[model samples]
Target: MKTPVVALLTDFGTRDWYVGSIRGVILVRCPRAQLLDITHEVPPQDVVAGAFTLAGAAPWFPRGTVFVAVVDPGVGSDRSLLAARADGRYFVGPDNGLLALALANAKRYAAVRLTNRR
Candidate 1:
């Protein structure tokens, strides 16, 4: 099987351990996955900026790349988590419009609310 590419985007800056923690979780779960950092510099809780940045960067990546964006200000609330496939790539993120622009540009796409926490 081809090695999976997982890209991460977040408002969590590099000065702290958040980025490392996220990377550690991914590595623990999928040791062979190739991880890329899109950017962790989106303004804090700025969903629109996150959306714009993600849309801009999504096209440059290869098909089958998975993007994980974490820019939600509504974390731990009722907002849904989403897993979406758009333009042949995958996106996993909060359903707070951060993934909207990217999904909009896709010729074909599908999204689902992720209810399974385990």
Candidate 2:
């Protein structure tokens, strides 16, 4: 009976309203979702920074955690979204090669590029 935690990583700055809006979107979708800000100051479009932040914190979190990363410079573009599974966790983000080296082991699970969520 534990609450699920959603670790969010993005390039949106704290000064802007993007981060807040994303949180709000999550809240509206799932009020019980525990939103954890991994980091908003991810070097402003720095994909590596975002991947590192997510890959670092993902392991320490409990099972069933969802890592939502949005360091995408290709947002709303044709870069295709991804939902990767690794080490008892789920990762949701774009397929921008940034995540190529995120995971520690990098060879544990299958990585899939999801165009649309079901």
Candidate 3:
């Protein structure tokens, strides 16, 4: 079996610890997982940009790749987190339409409104 890959796309520029913190947590949970950066330079709070970026690049990655995308302006609000599987790739991010464009390309897609607050 192939090792799983988790790609990260965030507006959290490289100057901060946000990306590092997320990477650390993923590493702790799945040390053997391969990590890839979609981009950390997305304009802050620009979910549209983040969504398009992921959609454009998602198809080229291996199937079963997981993408963690964050361009949230409503981070502290009651905005829900989303988990979506589309075109054989997995996505986790906010539910503010950030995943819509990407999920649109999926030949087979499914999403669930996550109730987990973590």
Model 2 per-residue lDDT tens digits across residues 1-118 = 5677898888888997888998998899889999998888788778877777777777788878888888888787788887877777888888885555555554576688785654
Q: Which stretches of candidate 3 lie above 4 Å from their native place?
A: none
Candidate 3 structure quality by residue, lDDT tens digits, 1-91:
6889999999999997989999999999999889999999999899889989989989999989999989999987899999999988999
Residue 4 lDDT (model 2): 76
Clashing pairs in 3: none
Each candidate's clash count: 0, 0, 0
In model 1, pairs of residues that clash are none
Looking at model 3, which ten-residue stretch has the lowest summed lDDT?
Answer: 69-78
Scored against the true structure, residue 75 in model 3 reaches a CA lDDT of 81
Per-model TM-score versus the true fold: 0.97, 0.87, 0.95
As a whole number from 0 to 100, the lDDT of residue 58 in candidate 1 is 98
Candidate 2 has a TM-score of: 0.87
Model 2 CA deviation exceeding 4 Å by range: 104-107
Candidate 1's residue-wise lDDT over 1-118, tens digit each? Answer: 8999999999999999999999999999999999999999999999999999999999999999999999999876888899999989999999899999999999999999999976
